[model samples]
Target: MAPIERRSGRKRALVNGEDIEKKNTLKRSLRQRTDTVKKEKPSTDKVNNNNINIDKKKVLESSSKENVEPPSLASNLPKALSCLNRVQPGIQGFIPHGLHSNNILYRLQHNAMGITRERSLRQAVVQSYSDQLANYRILTTASPFDRRVTAMQWHPTLPTTVAVGSKGGDLILWDFTKTEGITFMQGIGAGGSVTHLQFDTTDPSFIYTSSIDGKVSRQDFHGNNKTVFLNTMDWSYWYCSLDVNYRSNVLVSGDNLGNTVLMTRQGEKVWSHRLHKSKVTHCEFNKQCEWLLVTASTDKMVKMWDIRMVSGRKSALYELPHDRPINSAYFSPDCSRLLTTDQNSEIRVYGGPLWDKMERTIPHPHRFFQHITPIKASWHPIHELIVIGRYPDPQFPGYHHGENRTIDVFDANTGDMVCQMLDGSAKGIISLCQFNRDGSYLAAGMGLNTLIWTDVAKLTTQGALSVNKTISGIGLNPNRGSNTSQRRRNRRNNNDDEVDKLKKKLKTKTKTKTQTKTKTQTKSKSSRR
Candidate 1:
């Protein structure tokens, strides 16, 4: 009976434990269901709000479309709404249907209606001169004794000193550093229109000027003493260009009749060569003192001469043929190239082995054309750039009706077209273009005004400077020293030595033959006696 009682008590305890576990499981599942319902309630509310807003938008859009009292207003609403939707939130207010039609009509009327946006954009670009204009400043302007200024030169060593020549044959020196403004250093009246002027590389104080009055005059800038270097009256119609070999004291002058005369600084004539059948336009000297002279005539031909052998009276080393009259010729800064501007407005470059051969003619690059009659051309001192100035076409007369006076710059080495500047507003033509000695500034001479341009900033932005301003005079300041003079004297002495040796050899041979003849004559006289 005691064992039966213990087994019944254990069964009763096990049954009570199973009943508590079932009640705890039911409470936990009920709490989980309540928490899930709390989370799903907010999600269901958000979905209902979204459906209501979508329905409202559709109703407003449909209402606006159906209320077509004003046809134009209704037609423009969709476009305006589309544009408004694309606008960012910070821009304007969100619009409803009542004001939407009016707003659409306002926008449609104000919109660039009937205008091609592309055409308007192109017009804006064309009218924008924001990047094209240039800033120019005048440094100094020194008027000479005569109002007709023909030529001017800056001192090689002093930037503030300048020599000016007048059409009245007056050479005036002006000191720019003076407070009295331009103080006259000296005046030399050489009795001719000073057509051309240059300073001696060896002596900056000594200046040379040539005139159409048939005279080449040399003057000391500090002293009033003047010397007539050569009289061109007997040689030709007028003296057009003058270049001096400061190291060799050899002066070369070109005349209107295409005659080139080589003379010593002491006024001894060395040799003369007739290069062109027409007028000789300009002349230049290379570092080797080899002469490069160009002649142009109404006859339409430009000739280049290598006058290094002219001391021996030889013909020109080279002659370049042209179909039109050459107005100007320039030797590049390297002295290895030549540029000739002609009446046909073509800028031709001649280079290669033909530069050395006197008779060899090489075909120039054909694609390079200026297309306007060029009056003057200059080369950039440090770059392979050539700048040319154009004149009014003879076929056209006035400024408004005539061909535009233009300036063109080209890559001299590769013959690539770089930039063009057209002056349709100006009245006169550009007469000359000159690059400063450092090549930092480019000066152009027009009718009565001189234009000076800073080259660095323009080249950085627009690749080149525009040719609109007028320039009447241009000057380059280069430093000269005793070393330069000594070098020139040494070169001159070497040339003198070569000539002396030839003369000495001839004298020796003549004496030897004379002695031989004397011996034979004495022997024959003794036999006769």
Candidate 2:
């Protein structure tokens, strides 16, 4: 019985030990599970925080991109106004007058505001005209047989008279103020189309005309005499263009056969030279009688020639090359520069020293498309501005389809475009355009109607004061007026003159006083003796 009780106690002890082991195992498993749960919670929180950070970075990147774009139209207003103020600061609130058309006769008064101070002050039309039908007063008209009026010119001295040249070779002179049909002057057949016409600056009655037949004729408006100054037979081909100097003694003609002829008043060829591979389009003489000839050819080259030394012989002093065929060329008023227009609607300028090497070549600043071909170019008489005439565009039809005749102003110094004027309704092509001697009037011949733009006063004033200030040192300070410097200069000159006169008077008075004193002393000495 004792052995049986001991075995039961051992069995109970073993069972209790197994139960304690099981409890320890359960506690260890619970701790392991708790530790695993803590580690998982930290990893989940880290992933969620990283996602929030990525979203914030994306938002910042989007905001930065938006800030980098260009400013909108509304934002540019201040900048544009600032630029305008910088360009024109004087006379605040001075509004510019609009160009108004009264019938086809547009009267433009040359405003005195823009001229350089040294030039003489004159009020003239930067543009004016009269035509035949009397539809437009103060304009010139075409003839019965005239296909188109190619060129027009007013007598340099006779302001009331004007001459019109047509494609039919007829030269008509009209007293613009008269109500009659016109005072027509019958001249010789122009041979081909008349390309250019000019009144002799030296002789008001003498007029010159250039034709495609290679003939340049001089006609006396006062008389019925028409003399051929130059003919194509003298040169290689027909004279396509020509110009006479202010002296009226020398004539320059450009021919279709790439030849330039320099002739005298007696129809004698002074010199002849081949300038380009293509037809010579235009020729002109500088103010000093130094010649600058421009020749445009099918070769797409415009050659500049200086013939100052070879007035008696056929030789060129200098030649310049261009990329396109030039249709017309004009020299600035000072003759320090030249401008050439091409068939490609491009205008180029070359600096000049009469017969020396060219200084530089500059392209026209205005953007002109290929469809708008420039046919004629003329320089303003007093200002460094140019007028370009665009020929009819073959692609476009009807009035709207035609090339709009444009007159653009450029800074002769910087070649920067300043302003542009256009003819909205006029059709046909502009064959010739000229600025009158005063630079206040511009005359243009279009098809059957001759259009004149008068009262160019705004142009005269637009840049005149600024140019004057720059050149003459006027209006430099806000407290000082333009007359201050001028008055100072005048005072200095007057003081110098006064000093000179005082010195002269002192010498004379001293001589007279010395003579009188000498006589009195001699008399006194004799009396004392």
Candidate 3:
């Protein structure tokens, strides 16, 4: 075999010749496999549903030849090889892998549980607190001044006008009767802080502003006169608070010097009381008795005073003791209850003729979580619920990320939190909040901004939607309309006469004064020469 020679005359060993033959055979087998796969790939693309028509007659005829022995192969094959004879391979399902019995059912003599426990809890909520409120919305938070708003009060008869006193000592009156027709005006002074504002009950345009300059000026929008009544000499201390009693035609004002002065409607001092050792933070009159007054101070005492009993310090009726400085002391709308709040986040409700008996003390919803500052609580006009505004106490356990502040409603009687309205902007601390007489609107003063939450549903029913486009042309009632029109006509007549007479008188006086001044100047120049 080692001496073999090829017929082509090239010398080749028998071992090398056999190796070449085996290599050629392996290459032929690989080329055949690749050629067959290429052919099968194109045949798959040529497949069409219409060309493979399934005939029932063919299938029935083929069924009769089932007795024939199947062709032997490496594996068992489906007889017809249809698509239905195959299935998706998975771990478990209604049909088990290789026909195993995993999914099962039992009759159990007709007794059964309809739904699993996990599924039962996935149903709709039964106590839906979201449905209790109507179409409530925060219209806006407006801060017109450079500093935090200090004083705020709503117009007595009108829901549209809210008088806000800025820390700059200017009163900005916002008219939201028609938001598009809103207007504001600067009032009184930039002399000092306008600490408080109280609108007159009988007059829509008449409002009183207390300034830190020791001046309480009665500003009326009805006329051009801003200072109808200004008592500067009597009130030497900055006026901290002011309240008007329309029935008694009197005004009660508390000062930073702990002096509470009772003034008549004409700004005449009727009486004065100086018993508090600290500044009077708040003062409010009882709805039933205009003579009765409750003033809260930093002295930790809420003292009640009657203008009629203005004899001495003995005239002070009752003093409510508090653990911390009292922030607000207000009587309920019906005059049947009294509410007091302290800097320690304590709220107390009192009932009885003199509000001497304590009804309940509401728990702080924020608990021991510390707020950077405290806020006053507002009582619902017709219910036993009070709204307490709070921000997410950063001191809350595990608290790191701050959230939007919330105004929580709580039951005044049971001390349970009811609902909450989130301040989506996460604005600064809320300082003041109050409800209207009918409780249709809530005004919250947060930081330098005033946020008004209006009961749009209740307002719509009351024909607020029918308000005219004119800022002051809302016809709320026919009687009020007629009365206002008459008063306006009379005021116009008086103003016209006064302006004409005063203008003529002023012109004549100025002419005379200028002539005299000119003559005096000429003489002085001659003397100098």
Candidate 4:
């Protein structure tokens, strides 16, 4: 009886040990699962910071459509080929009937096919433009200084060169053509926030800059700089704006003292006029006339001046009055029209000699002018559109009531809002905006951040290409760039080194032959003697 009882006890102990091992296995599995879940989870901090990045737009797009491809034109290709085959070579016109076969069904099939193929080609062209427009994205961003980028200018002739001036008086020169990295050169500091900046037409390295402290300066990318215009007067008066006409070697400037002044490139005051009752907000030179200058002031007036007249007789040739302070005044590409943005949140266009002819008045997106910082609008090179930054809506869930950080593009001729660009997911205020020479890119000064956007209005040629029903029949090509085959041909043409080498070899061979002939003649004379 004692032996049997011991055996039962040992069996019970073994069962309990097996149960303990099972419990330990379950715990280990639970721990491993918890670690895997933790590893996959997004850290809370990373999510918050990425919201401000411009890639938010791309993220929004990806979530809505997972790699959805554009409609393929391949299916229509065979039909188009069949229609083309019906037509004979050396002929521009299409065939109404299939020869040899002479089948009525074949002729009718191609007749319908011809119309359908042309329509598809036109639709494909239109679709291509829409896709091109959708691809406008931020190429790159540079903000070296902690201060706000106040003004920026692209080199008129150079594709990759750009200059930016910040509120902290720092000048940053950036060149994108370098493959190693973007080359950054910091020049001498300005007196105050750089209100305006431009490139030297003759010298790629030199640039002109104007500051709020009444100092106009010239700086080279090598850090060498000299103040061309100094404010020795009351010091209370600061330069409100400055513009240089490199063709005439003259500078047209405006100041807080309500003075419109013209000076030489060396900084000698040639002409000065105190026309506005308040600060002169902006000044522009007419592209058509080197002597013509346009000035807009906070006193609600825009005046055009021909610098050829005497200082006393330098009265404005045209007077444009506004209900609010004019922040910016620009002439159209043709110089036949004028545009201005006012504190009233309006973009006004005028024509005629006196600019009394009102063409259109388009309102900006950020209409309430309660803020002191005035918003600016720019003209597309073709004069077909104007783009300005829009203020945020007050009703946006977490939006602050004050500044609108988005951009609104408007049609100048039709006075309609065409498109808009937002400032990522974060709230940022763009104080000023400027279009590049070709109107391909737009640079907006958003506090310390300079937002560069691919302007959607650049579809000027594509929009033209899609207008007509037939591709070749319209006789107008609206492609923004050269045809792909033409571009390849150009690349081939650029490789002329082989031809140059062959020409050089021929010249050398001819010289050697002439020397050999002279030597051989001398040898023959020697042998005869």
Candidate 5:
């Protein structure tokens, strides 16, 4: 009986050992399956976390590379930027005006809230115009000359009429109102190129052309008759720049020999001054102040002269010196500021009343080379904004490695880049750009090709309101301001809101995914325990 019991106990022990082995094998198989699942599918929380980090890095990199300030960031962020920065920070509540707004403490405390009424009004107007900056579609393209286009101008009174002068001494008068387009085309230069073009102040039918051959020609509207208006006579000197004052019908021209000649509409020289040691690159008369004349020169100086106090080279009324040769100088629409572009990488703004001090210096790339025309900064006809052709430099802020050269618009007051205008039609460097009388149309000259852009919204609304009047060139509609401004504001706000909502949704989705993953892990661990 003992032997039988011992055998039964041994059998029982063997059965228990088999049960233990079976449990171990099941655990091993389950572990293997779990390992394979883990290998095939990572933990969602970790994966989602990695993806969020990657997305954020990509967003930051793209933003830095593009150099475009997203409206969400620009409008919502509290920035400690300079007071001169036109971008207002996202500050809540009313801010008191400070006596010294430029002080660091005031700038930190006010964040653009301490702006004066005049400055506020000016900025408001500039902002209103800035809102109209949509991508200007290429309205038209034309090859008006055989050689490079050096000068372009829109008729002061005729909205559709434009004149372009070429390096081959060729002139083309184009009227967008006509189907044939070319109203006049002529070669008015004897041996040199046409340097500048200007329209007569009182007569839209007459135009002025200056040539490197030392001749300024006046042509009738039809281009049938050309009269040699002003001949420098000394075949050595040539007119380089020309501008006419519409108020007084007084014309001003700069010559390569550093002469700034003021003339009457009758082609008689009022006075000539040796304004610079080098060639005069640009001469302009203030549209608002007829007697105020400004001249830029290759001698690295910009000088302002009041023609009323005219004398021989007896020092300019006010002079702004530069480190590099000045390419062009222009007065603001209100004649309260002067904008000058230099051959090197600098653009300067001189404040008005007394033009002695340089208000701001904006760094820009405009290296002068032989193949390209000198880049000249121009003023928006009605706003406190500046426009200039951008030289393609990898180091330039908005320039990409392989992108086409663009036209840059800047805020004259704040010295901030406002926007860039680019299109497929502008394949070459846009060396010249000009705004029409009311600033509704813009024309740019690229090599020999001419590109024109009209405000899309303005054109559309005008077409819808009075198609016949628009076609007939009646004028701008005065009643379209309020609704257009409101629409622009609404669109801008909607865009910002949409971008913000998308960002918020992404953050929420990540949070939800992480929370769900954590909860699932906790439940699985509890069940295992």
Candidate 6:
């Protein structure tokens, strides 16, 4: 009995130990499960918090959108200054041109309704001015310099004072208003061959000049009192172009290595940027929108920038690509259109409110080559017409198929040939030309000489020569006497005249139906007919 009891007690003790281990195992499993739950609680909370932040952001966006003004209210407010919103808040204080009355911003809203009346008035003025331009003839020709003429500008206020620059660093101020005593004074080496010139709008007595000598200069109309406004002394870099904004008291200049620098009128540098890859051939500030700037580069690009938004290597507002190097880009008189001349035989006009869109493309050959002045189409000061020199290519279509070289004036809107300024005296390529501020006169630079043309009827000036008359023995063509092209043109005109005369005679001598047909018609026809 005792042995049996001992075996059963041992079995009971082993079973009890097993039961104890199972209880421990169960407690450990429970603690592990609780620890996992605690660890996951913060993670789940974090996910919920992220969801809440997303909801808040969406709601804020919706609320902001809802708070926007209605279109009706927005239309009543000004539009031009709205572009200022895109600029940094701190920049508006420095650019005062935005508030000037002459700029477009100070006027009624751009693209506003009921503006057709203003447009109609402008069109009427253009028509009257264009009619006067048709009667224009060369007033005189003056040799301002012995070097090739590069740039020219008329005084902003002085009606007859004109500034001319040449490739050999000559600046000439000519007063053509005098009929008897035409006077011109020249300064040598103002800069190395002034490439661009602009008369100060605020002070017409002063003029700004950009030159190939890496300098920008401000001087008097007499080409005296020159003060260097900006200079890039590096040998590989020189100022190729510059523009001044009188209202803002700022000047922007671009160099050959694509560096564009902004400076105060007093010659303090504001900022500089590498705006192009190659040479910056042209740079202009929009007169109407003074904050806007345009630049053309030999890298086959024309870019527009809102100077306010061009901060720290930012991209341009719009980038226009060209098939070839661009000669120039200019804003129209109204600043509503942009014109660009490219070497690949294209002249493009871009219109607003979005200037990026090309409105018209005029196919004209103004070739780019060495040893010739670049032909850039210039805008008429008062009319919507453009003038450019016709490249001397016989294959290109022109007046007499380029045989009689003439400066062409094209209607900007329709891209139609408006008029050809053909003069027997002004031979050779008229590479550079610009209309006076009044649009009453024009000056063209042709091979070291400047030719002035004016309306004889309007100006009432004496000694206005006919287009066919040579001026001071300077109008003779080098190949005029025995040139095959000239002979061919003369022969063609003669043939046309002879043909017209024969046609007139035949028309007058029509045969009548012979009533007395038989003998009289046969016998008298030999003598009387």
Name the regions of candidate 3 deviating beyond 4 angstroms: 1-135, 177-180, 187-191, 221-223, 228-236, 365-374, 391-404, 455-529
- Clash count per candidate: 10, 39, 0, 2, 0, 0
Per-residue CA lDDT of model 5 for 251-365, tens digit only, reads 8888888878888877787888787887998888877777888888998888888888878566579878899998888888788888898997899999888899789999987
Model 2 alpha-carbon miss at residue 472, Å: 48
What tens-digit string does per-residue lDDT give for candidate 1 at 149-253?
Answer: 555565666644556665566565555334343434433444466778888767676788898778888777555687997775653378978877766668888
Superposition error at 9 for model 1 (Å): 86
Q: Is candidate 3 or candidate 5 better by lDDT?
A: 5
Superposed Cα RMSD, model 6 = 25.1
Given candidate 4, what's the lDDT at residue 479?
20
Please identify which of the two predictions, 4 or 5, would achieve the higher TM-score against the true structure.
5
Could you tell me which residue pairs clash in candidate 1? 156-478, 247-488, 317-358, 445-471, 446-471, 449-470, 449-471, 449-472, 450-471, 450-472
lDDT of 4 by residue, 1-529 (tens): 1222225644642235444554555445434533453365433323222222222243335423544322232223334323432545685876543432323454446557774344334333333333433445444344455455777888788655668877667776655323233344543444467777888888867877777767767778666665567563545777878888878888877788787778888889887778788998888888777877788988888887778883542366878889888888988888878889887557898874556788998866444354324677777664356677776556434556655466666666667665556534224666676767776666666655455556344334344322211122111121222234445655677667778888999999999999999999999999999
> What's the TM-score of each model vs. the native?
0.51, 0.51, 0.57, 0.57, 0.62, 0.62
Candidate 6 matches the true fold with a TM-score of 0.62
- All candidates' lDDT scores? 0.54, 0.55, 0.63, 0.62, 0.71, 0.71
For model 6, the stretches where C-alpha displacement exceeds 4 angstroms are 1-132, 179-191, 221-224, 312-314, 394-402, 456-529
All-Cα superposition RMSD per candidate: 29.8, 27.1, 24.1, 30.9, 33.4, 25.1
Q: What is residue 226's positional error in candidate 2, in angstroms? A: 2.4
Q: Which stretches of candidate 1 lie over 4 Å from their true place?
A: 1-149, 152-154, 159-164, 170-191, 232-236, 289-299, 306-314, 356-374, 392-407, 414-417, 420-427, 455-529
lDDT of 2 by residue, 1-529 (tens): 1222225644643235444554555445434533554465543332232222113233334434544222242233334423432445577675334323322122223223442222112111222221111121112222222345666777777555668776666666755444452555544544566777888776667788787666788877555687987765643356777777546467788777776778787788777876667676666666654454544554566545555655322354555555666666677878777777766545777775653344444343223344322356677777666666554445433425534545555545555554555544444455566767775445666554455544434335444222112112221221123344556876999999999999999999999999999999999999999
Q: In model 3, what lDDT does residue 493 have?
A: 92
Q: Clashing pairs in model 3?
A: none
